[model samples]
Target: MSKHEILIVDDEPANLQKLKRTFLTDYTVHEAKTGDEALLILKERPVVAIVTDQRMPGMSGVNLLRQAREVRPDSIRIILTGFTEVEYLMDAINQGQVHRYITKPWEPVALKEALRQEIERWQLRKENERLSEELRLANEQLEKENFRLRQEIESLEPAGKQLVYESQEMRELMRLIDRVVPTNSTVLIQGETGTGKELLARYVHDQSPRADQPFIPVNCGAIPSELIESAFFGHKKGSFTGAIENRKGHFELAHQGTLYLDEIGEAPLDLQVKLLRVLQDAEIMPVGAQVAKKVDVRIIASTNRVLSREVEAGRFRQDLFFRLNVFAVFVPPLRTRRDDIVALSRYFLDRCRRRLNKPIPSFDPQTLALLRGFDWPGNVRELENEVERMVILSEPDQPIPASMVSERVRLASSTGGSDAGGLKEKVAEFERSLILEALRRHGHNRSHAADALGISRQTIIAKLKQYQLDDETAEG
Candidate 1:
């Protein structure tokens, strides 16, 4: 800790010496014979506390304390006075802002205690301000990191990556994702189904050093329990009754690349042990083969299940859990990233139009509002599907009606509820309205609508799909 400086201003040389001696051991004491001299010293140095005599030639102790407050508002002030006048004390308290008043013939211990307490208060205030500054800086850094991560995710130009969201928590998580992406660390991504866990995993792989290599995705839950090992480790020709020829496992194919093991919590306990061995040794033993083959594969595992609970229940190996948890990233569900919903919706709509080779349709105000209000349990994937459905159903020149959207989604525009729920619903409603207004301004032309929204034509189509406002069946 830096030394605390105390300024003492008194006309009498003896009194200045006495007070200086009392605090010299615990603090750095600067003594002055007059208030003007003390002010000069204060201007030159950083003083944490000030002690002044009430009676002086040019300036009183109260006036000096008030001046000290202007220079250092946080500085502790003490007044030393012989007068017992109530008016003087009141003026000292009001103008000089004295923290404590010391009468003539003061007790040494009492004076020391008062000085110590004043010093403590000053230190505490400084410390709190410092901590607050640090927290603000930390939050800013986290937001930048999240922004970079989101950009990286958008660079993928995935099917549904056009949503706009303003969640601090999600931004922090995105920053964590960026930090862990460059290394070959095993990442465990957790979230509910459709929460874009796979998108996050893919982002990690794409941004990693092994971006040039293949990204092999495996759904652990999709594979049969009996064929788990053979599927992961490969099988030699005639190794088993169905093994017609030698086939390489996902591990071999993913050499020097990323293997996204989705739904890893569903893997059987026996397979978990094998998976652990592969992760630890960087080698795999193929089915019906005695030798273990070394491979350079980066593991990016994801699961919606709570693995800690699984470990506690003996369903997942604790050792394996630790190995895969070198970096843990949680993808927030759609409800958490509402800021990105409109952007994502527009992106999906555009993609659907491109794929269907049809002109993109416009979204009605009510329809856009309903899309935002819906609770997307299925996440980005669900949103994409909904958008595609709408695009195929609506006509090229027609605007999608709000009546087509489910009532549950429409309720998002309603007033009052839980803070999280209400905010999400309101944002959704706002997004819907914005999109419709843009479409109306552009005369239902997707290209013009995109321009009006200050986004690309492709982005508008994606948005249309995300809101489920396709133009397939509308009157052209």
Candidate 2:
């Protein structure tokens, strides 16, 4: 059988025979005495190109190609007509019924060349479509693998724990995370406080090839500046007044694993230079030591502060920012993902109920609406606290009511921020005082205070920074 198929149509017997004989050496040629006959042959067999005569009985070449388009839209079409009848085929060309045409008494070589080119075009298009399908399937498989990795991480969490996401933006973010996970490249996660930046970092580490190794997480802002060097690098015995013996620092502890640097923007400038050196050389020089030890650790850093802004303000080193920002993911704040608020609220409530041994099981519609309407400046962390409080206070087996929601969320929803600035300032003032009281009640221990307030420790730390609460001097 010939490799390519071609159909030729004409009203005369001699013309049809000549055309068939011309292309028979290279193609499987089908012949028709009229346009109607050609279309009938096309319905029975697939052809790569169709060449038809313009003047025919019952149907014309243009009409046949137009109908043939519905049957084989991918076929290449050419019209055969006299030089004087070229005007008639112009309309066919304009309507997309024809690709090219040869006048009567055409050169056999020229016609053969044209048909060969059409066949090549068809083959190239089919190839492109095949490649596109392969790419689509590859992406689908990657998504599945990412999801399997995420579930593996989830298995490590307490029962009923899952990342609550309903927004398209968050779903896309998950896809991005899946693509970036297998690579050892450094990743920088930027988001507002309480937006789960660290969770994303953990996801990356868990999905990576280094999943079996330890995943060390360090809060750069929480570590005291005086001991930052010792905390990051090992300390030899008698290095300082408190150094009773040699100690392994974060780098040594995290060797062959992943090291997560949280609040990286808060690292002191002098420490940033040292951190940059370690990142560059994959080695650490411990305190009071002349020797630098090599390390094999992947770095994944996160910061709520915009490091670019910090760099501009001369607070963060530009070199360190570039090293950590090889790949970046931004976690959307809860306010922008309001659709997930109700789901997250339910999830947190379930966890709180199990922990506190409470019987409250759900939230009434009014309470759900109240939760969704709030701006949630503290994002998921604050929402969890509110739901926990509601679960603790509501009666057993009862749905949480709007009354259980804090006044800040309730009043903001009711007023619609008619006086946005004044209302926001007043709200900030109330939040600062509330946080202060919680801290005081917990003996100034941020962790205990964070647990009591139902917010993340990072959120509490961020608030303290906003209110200028000195950790060393704050009484409560």
Candidate 3:
């Protein structure tokens, strides 16, 4: 609501003074004696309108306006010319550089009117731009809320599938999913690869009213970036070179069902924006089609990467992350759920043997111990594969022994057992070195050494006793 500022440039002091007096009552007038000085004023202030005399020293009025165009292209420009040259007028009109032109010996009233008109025009343009930016932000907010409400409606319905789990970690995960299933909220399932994110997504789908519908799972990482748009939102025939037939996209095919976007963090940035728009508006325009089609699918996205970190690193969009992270469920890795290791191993073993027509006994105590101790970085999938491998290779009568376990598992077990013993030895050695150094620096004064190291004399004596450092010191 501040008054609009105007800049007046003229080599003549009388012209500059006369022009300033005309607009003194209307605007905050800034005067410049030369075109170069006027440009400096334009850079320093938000002068919406500029009026310059055509015959100026060094730079002409049209040239000044042209340079001003480079600095503040939005500012309205006017030129004051005494001679009516066709070429000068053509330069002003052709380049579309000057907004208005006035002749010398002009009436004060007419010049005032032109300045007033240009100022009003500049103000109107600024208001339009401001409103446009506001509208864009408002539309984005509305779409976000619209997407949220759509999910909430689906979530209120009853569930379809119940998950199976014995470990506290997975039980907690299921309980979290139970609360999330009835709402139309978007769910982001995060975990390491092979942590059963897809299984969990299926569980959520089965538990929800949408369980009766299809549960389409798309691995975003596996899809080629170029085909991502067509894969998510179908395309028209001849949309591109390879578009031979009409295809319903994943969103359309999964209508009224669940769209499981797995490995979602790997999706291309360009696709991420499109995906965000789809979530916001619940609609997608097919490639080569002018109209967008509506879709009704519950969104449950999964990713192995830390999406919040991805946002910080500029790899993922924050707005898209917010839309997809309305609800979150984290699948526990196999190593953290130790209780399930033996049970999962046995289940996979029995199922593998039944299929292969081989009867294998349960693992022996040593093998079971090894399995429990080895950290399963590959999670449930790795355990299942290993069990299947052992079943296919092992003798039917012999119980699965520790030797049957893979070298990595055996190495992990051996390393796991020695970690504590080796760490204690390393700590004692470090402590001995520190105490010796501190004593040597303090001239072997136990009290001074304790003070230097920020410990009590008694504590240092206890350390000396524990490491038997006193005997070595006595020999020295």
Candidate 4:
């Protein structure tokens, strides 16, 4: 540590020498012959402690200590007063906040002990202040990071699972996803089969800062329980049944990149515990491994099941559910975003034609009407398949017919009901019905349905909110 300066004010030379010998080992001694000289030394240097004689020529020791208080509130003050200067001792206590009072011919050990205690108190106060400042800075940084993460999550909403829709809902989802892709927070995507949850996860990873690194997608449900650990945390050679060679786990492979765990809800309870530990600690221990390996991987988990319900039912870990739910992107189904059905159908139709090396064809008005009427349970995935089928069957220059759509979808659209209600009321009802139906179909792929429509994904999201559709129904 650096040396502390101690100012000694006394007109007598012998007294100054005595004070110097006492504290010379612990502090640098500055001798001031008078109170005025003591004040001058204090002005030029940072003194940690002050020792002064009561009787001085121009100024008294008490007055000097009082003035020093204004310059350095933290400095320890000591008054060396004789029996005759009892009044000065009282004055020093009240005015200078004197830390300790010493009398003439004081014992050497006692004087040293008093100075040591005061110095220790001063050091403790400084340390406490330093810690408080550090804590304040840390909290401020955390708040900023949280806000930025929220914004990034919001931006990703627009682009998420919206490739199938032509509605405003698709736009909204895209916007939210865009905002969230820049941060380091984990993302949770919830959608049904064929809703393109993996596709959206890839989109997020592609748009993130870690885009240049690997984007490893793992189907948690597809992996066998016995091999899950090896797949996730890697295994040493000869450690497992198939361990002819060492293998890097998903976490290691995705270092400085993203690890997309699809169907996370289906992970076994035992594996869930291991996954939680990795997320919490950023380190993983491979199967039969003695030590944990550190990895820097961004996790993006997806599921078609209701995780909260799964947690409540004891099928999934509550802590793990909360951790993954930090940021959720729900993909809507196809039927809910009916407004984009026509547009999406046309886009898919054109795409299919190009892929098949066939001329682009238009859909007849009846075919458009038939598509709008169908309640798509399979969401965008179903829609794309249907379009591909139509492209293959239809002639190069022929317009697609209403009969080309599945008989069930065609019957529902054509014979559902009359369209005589007021436009606003009818539109509102249509939106509500679509949202609910999409949620039921494709297991509520909000992102998929939103994309199928030509609108922003947020719009379909708002409808879900306005309609008060539960996740089970909206996503089912």
- How high is the CA lDDT of each candidate model? 0.78, 0.83, 0.81, 0.78
Runs in model 4 lying further than 4 Å from the true structure: 1-164, 419-476
CA deviation > 4 Å runs, candidate 1: 1-169, 411-476
How displaced is residue 82 in candidate 2, in Å?
A: 99
Better of 1 and 3 by TM-score: 1
RMSD of each: 26.0, 24.4, 21.6, 18.9
lDDT by residue for model 3 (1-476), tens: 57789899999899899989988888899999888898999999988888888887799888899999999899888888876654676678678799888877878899989988877787788899999999967964664455445545654433212234569988787778899898778899999988889878877887788866667788887888789889989899999999998777889767887899999999989989999999999999988899989899999999999999999999999999999988987888889998788668777776777778787756654566667777899988898888888888788856677678899887776677564554335335545766787788777888887765556788778888987886345211
**lDDT per residue as tens, model 4, 360-425:** 457654566667767777877787888888878877777777668778776676566666434344
lDDT of 2 by residue, 61-89 (tens): 88899998888899999988889888888
Task: Provide the lDDT at 355 for model 2.
Answer: 75
Clashes of each: 31, 0, 13, 64
- Residue 177's C-alpha lDDT in candidate 4? 82
CA shift at 89, candidate 3, in angstroms? 50
The weakest ten consecutive residues by lDDT in model 1 span 157-166
List candidate 2 stretches off by more than 4 Å.
1-161, 417-476
**Lowest summed lDDT over 10 consecutive residues: which window, candidate 2?**
418-427
| Model 3 residue 32 CA deviation in Å | 72
